[model samples]
Target: MFFRALLLLLILLCSNCENQKGETSPILQGLLALDYLILSDPDRSSVYFSTTRSASVEIAYEDGAEPNTGNFAVAPTTSVWSVTESNLINAFADRGYTVNVTVPTDLSSMSEFPDQGRSTWTINQLLALVPKYKAEDSNFQSAKFFVVFVKGSLAENSGVIAVTVSGAFGIGAPTVFVFKEIINHFQDNLSPDKVRKAEQMTVTHELGHALGLVNTGIPLSSDHQDTAHGNHCTNTSCGMYWALGDDRVDSFSPGTNPLIFGSECITDIRDYTP
Candidate 1:
């Protein structure tokens, strides 16, 4: 009987030790904090964090269903942003994390953007840009999703992710406002044929920022090329590379679609996810 009692005690102690170890280990919790930044700029928004650690992500659109209120309507062809968001969600979902998208009406106001700095999307507009997920899935409700704006400048400086669209260059962020001189040059001097392609590539590039594949501005040596895309290395010929300009038609690789990140980029994301 004494031996059996001791055995029970040993089992309980082992279980308790495991629980304690789990409580103290940083791997799961550490991953969560990293994921918070990877998903979006939690610092800029007012989302709450939990004390307990878990492998789930939640996304809320700032103003998903509002009407467009800008000077001009968004072109029909520009609706690819929603497609891009869908692709992003699918890509993340394939990796075993849960993501959720919400549209909190109370958080839907234009004042979210500061007045003093460069004009950008109001919180309301940003919310509107976020795509709506119609398909019913419980997992999506628990995963990390992002908000987007349909009619505002593409410039977003949310904590670590900053996106700027160069409208004049016709290549980077499509919604960015450029100098009148640049706009005139593109309209008159540059080939009008390239505008559409440039706009698409620009959105993909900006999305790269959203995914945390940033340019470190360091020159690439031969040794670094395999790992870093020369200087722009991350994986999958990501749009984050600075060498891709608006003027060149071949700069946009259909095989390496801007929406899909390279393999190395995926590893970085997985590492960043909590």
Candidate 2:
């Protein structure tokens, strides 16, 4: 298994995390707190229901859905990501986790330079960018988990689809990164809705990691973890599948309508809050 105890040491350092109830919440202790790097942040990398849910998510999309300077034009709009935003909220809501999710109605934009930032960005670099973005709109200070959708590529060199540094130690902002370049890769072959499905699935999957599934933040209900693939589900078709591939994401398949959580994963979350 790639998920070694020593690797855990390298991925997560939650020094600033505190248990609101004197003990770490299941999500905080096991799942959400993991700090490993993926090809796509949380895509490579939800909300709903109940006020008691401790963590909330806010999704920030670049204003106007900037088209890449590269060949991948026709960026997915904020509405595209909003489909993901709603999907995420309902994913948690069904589990009774009480997570609240928000996406910007007035997304931030960068018309000055269509290529707003580098093709590849490091966590620290993205960190610096988030607050600067918030400076344009201070609402960021309120979100517990902030995901930024920018019109660029990340980990293009590593085959990583995206990146997130949420729950890492010494970090003040808990965040996730999504790149538009990924959308471009699919736009050529998949229908617009299918492409959007891939985008939404990535959003919810990463948030699942942040919510503590498959022994990351919350304890497991069964032995469903694909240890071979780190913290992903054993079922490749499942949303929480550990290793993601360009061609294999189940949500992208036509008629896979009403993207839903896998049964075993929901059992795990239920065990945590029940």
Best by TM-score: 2
Q: What lDDT would candidate 2 get against the real structure?
A: 0.52
- Per candidate, the number of residue pairs that clash is 26, 20
Window of ten residues with lowest summed lDDT in model 1: 44-53
lDDT of 1 by residue, 1-274 (tens): 2333454565556556668564534444544444443344231111111111111212222222122221112233333233344435434454453443232223332213222232354433443333242122212123232333222243443221224322121211112121112222333344432443343344445444433344221122222234334334533355445444443434443333435455555444444433
- Per-residue CA lDDT of model 2 for 147-258, tens digit only, reads 6677656643434555655534312344567776666474457655555556666666776665566676566788889998788899777778855566654335323343
Residue 250 Cα positional deviation in candidate 2, in Å, after optimal superposition: 6.6
Predicted structure 1, TM vs. truth = 0.36
Q: Supply candidate 2's per-residue lDDT for 65.
A: 46
Instruction: Please report, in order, the local distance difference test score of every candidate based on alpha carbons.
Output: 0.34, 0.52
RMSD of each: 14.3, 10.2
